[model samples]
Target: MSNLPLTSNKLLSTLSSSDYERLLPHLETTDLPLGQTLYEPNQPLNYAYFPLNAVISLVNILEGGQMVDATMIGNEGMVGVPLVLGTMQIPMSAVTQIAGQALRIEASIFRSTLQGNGALYSLMLRYVQVLMGQIAQNLACIRLHSAQERCCYLLAMMQDRVGSPELIITQEALSRVVGVRRAGVNEIVNTLGRAGLIGHQRGKITILDRAGLEAAGCQCYRTLRAEYGRLSRP
Candidate 1:
């Protein structure tokens, strides 16, 4: 297959023509399968990824083996922000939540591009603000929203990122993302399904009614979408 749609990433698509041409040769497409760790906390990041169709999950792993999701990076955002900030260490670990493609560049090379590339730097700055907003909104959503509402929001968000009704997630993983117990997640799942919002079996969940799912979710989903979707591109 041809390597088409390299600018499919919203962040990269905003690049100016000259900067894009200069950076093009250094970019490489890489496969990101489910559960693949892109970067771990306080570790060296080999590459920064600009997702094409994948959604990378950022999570905070507690000392006792518990994991809580921080935020997700889809085609609208790029990973490895810490590299541009003069650090390789971050508190959250980034892992692939949805299997798909991404454009990756070596961290060192990317930094070199920043040496006077105004557009890329400005874009990344805007991206950081977007990321911070997402994290804050998600924290509030988790604390204030009901489990069922949050479940609806999460499933809806995943559908948006994957651009398909099908979602590759188990109840266990979904529970982690929604910050709820597995049993609580099961109840939410049944509720949404009975309401004709979604369908699920094993490691897959499919959005059955997008409109209904949106109605079922909390306001945070809409907020995230507005901030991180169409308006997110620089």
Candidate 2:
């Protein structure tokens, strides 16, 4: 019970006992390391991952090799959403942002199970809506908000997902996600550090004042939270 990977995930936990039992045999526990590429742009998805403790990023890589995160999936959601809709290809990159374990299922099995499982299908549909809202909010945030505000927004989101004050990620990766230069990210981090909102160390950041960080972010952060909360309700 305690060692079961899917048991702790919000999405999997909501499944009916019988449905979970049917899929349990197909679930394989796997470790996702930091910076691991789950899927590349326009590539076939071999499996669907339901992360138990990992965080995955959906990033859009530009022609210039720059990347910007479109959305994030964790214990609350499943990756390889295209498999459910009869498509195995995605234009964005799916990468492991946090090293942890997940229940990886064959794409074919997941798709077949989802087709006959009303509860699972409906839950995934709701998650898709919530994810769309987050992506839209992120677009607006990037276009209208300052770098500092965006940094705060990212930190607040990471804190919510990981349920921890300490996040282990590099400034280079942070810059890519926020669509900014490394120097720009450094400046924002320095500002947050000086304001006592966060403490920075090599390859890690510790949130010192979550409330203050949220206060520094734009309304997009709150809007995204409300949308996800509404869709996630049982």
Candidate 3:
């Protein structure tokens, strides 16, 4: 597991022994269903999730009801980060993109645990910094990169998080992640499949060649991975 955390979540693993011990009692193991919205725009958060295998996306909803993923959170990080920073509400929605396990804690209790300027507090602050950098890169990729390149980057990231070559993701989810239409997603995935980078059929996508997938993706995927690598290092 990542950094030998009690759970697979690297953020939990990176916490100091005392810090981990203090929160262990309150952390509950839960299963997140795919497409479940953890929190919505301006909605008060109740629990923070430290995903062990589950992948969550922080999606920003536009005025016309279009949704774009700001960034994806996996075992590398936690949802409900704003609570630790004294903000109770967020403009984006945190939705579960993959169904898997997570260690969940009540937001109030979690906030109380970070009362002082301690190791956990410092660690989360750094994690937030890494997350911000990742979101920035993702936004840039969406604007400057092709749909095929962005799709490759997103699939590669999701595969890394779930530790599986095969992914159970819907065309709807693909459209949301790539900020494209359903027809566009079909076109992009078809191209990737034809090139042998990935095999997409219905709701499941199988990575046929990991190296080839990365080769097809833009540099943003590698950049995000490097940024997350720095988070666990702290």
Candidate 4:
């Protein structure tokens, strides 16, 4: 109901005027704090969130209760896609990995608007495609890349999504996201810091040199980035 600019969320900003107007009344702006659980596995989703600056991580829980990152959703896409697709449940857990804000809409209203098969539906489908692509690429990267390379890849991806060089995340969180041990994460962080690619202090990571980080990362980083750019273009 807020007439605030939708420009922060690219997915919403791309909606045609008519489609945007239809969904505008139902939209409410909200903040997403770090560690906020948007939804749990197999639970009904109550709302669909279009992130303005927040980054949500979709994680798969292993049998032993370890959480491995599946993919991350930022301003380029929406959370709660299961609701839009007519299913209220998702197998993975959704959490706010970064503290920021977003625009949200009730699940039922979002579903009805999506059922119209208009621009929102089409755009969301494209977003899903990109999401799937990134997940698949991550799978391969995890399998074939070294821990250091994977760390660089994750940092690069997060930098692009958040549109900032400085990230306020703990090493433990980075380890979980990269599916590596904390020791390994520390090693990678130290390596990057020594190379002048990044500065790490406390829980913050500042990208001192973007080009250097990209060069240290695996090819999957560039590949997924190019795919996202190509698929998500208006």
lDDT of each: 0.85, 0.84, 0.86, 0.85
Candidate 2 RMSD to the real structure: 2.3
Residue-wise C-alpha lDDT for candidate 1, range 158-230, written one tens digit per residue: 7776767999887888888888899999998988889888888999999999999989889988898787665
Cα TM-score of candidate 2: 0.91
The model with the greater lDDT, 2 or 4, is 4
Please rank every candidate by lDDT, starting with the best.
Answer: 3, 4, 1, 2
Worst lDDT run of 10 residues, candidate 2, spans 1-10
Tens digit of per-residue lDDT, candidate 4, span 92-142: 999988777889998988898888747788888888888888889989989
- Displacement of residue 77 (Cα, Å) in model 2 is 1.4
Q: Per-residue lDDT tens digits of candidate 2, residues 133-234?
A: 778888888889998898898888877666578988899988877779999999999999999999999999999999999999888788877776676465
Q: Candidate 3 residues 1-234, lDDT tens each?
A: 222244588778877777788889989888888989999899899998898888999988988998878888888898998997899899999989988778889999889888853788888899889888988888798889999899999999999887789888998898888889999999898888899888888889999999999998999998988887787565
Worst 10 contiguous positions by lDDT, candidate 1: 225-234
Model 4 scores a C-alpha lDDT of 0.85
Of the candidates shown, which would achieve the greatest lDDT relative to the real structure? 3
List residue ranges in candidate 4 displaced over 4 A. Answer: 1-5, 232-234
Clashing pairs in model 1? Answer: none
**By TM-score, is 3 or 4 better?**
3
Q: Kindly report which residue stretches of model 1 are placed more than 4 angstroms away from their true locations once superposed.
A: 1-4, 229-234
| Candidate 2 vs 3: which has more TM-score | 3
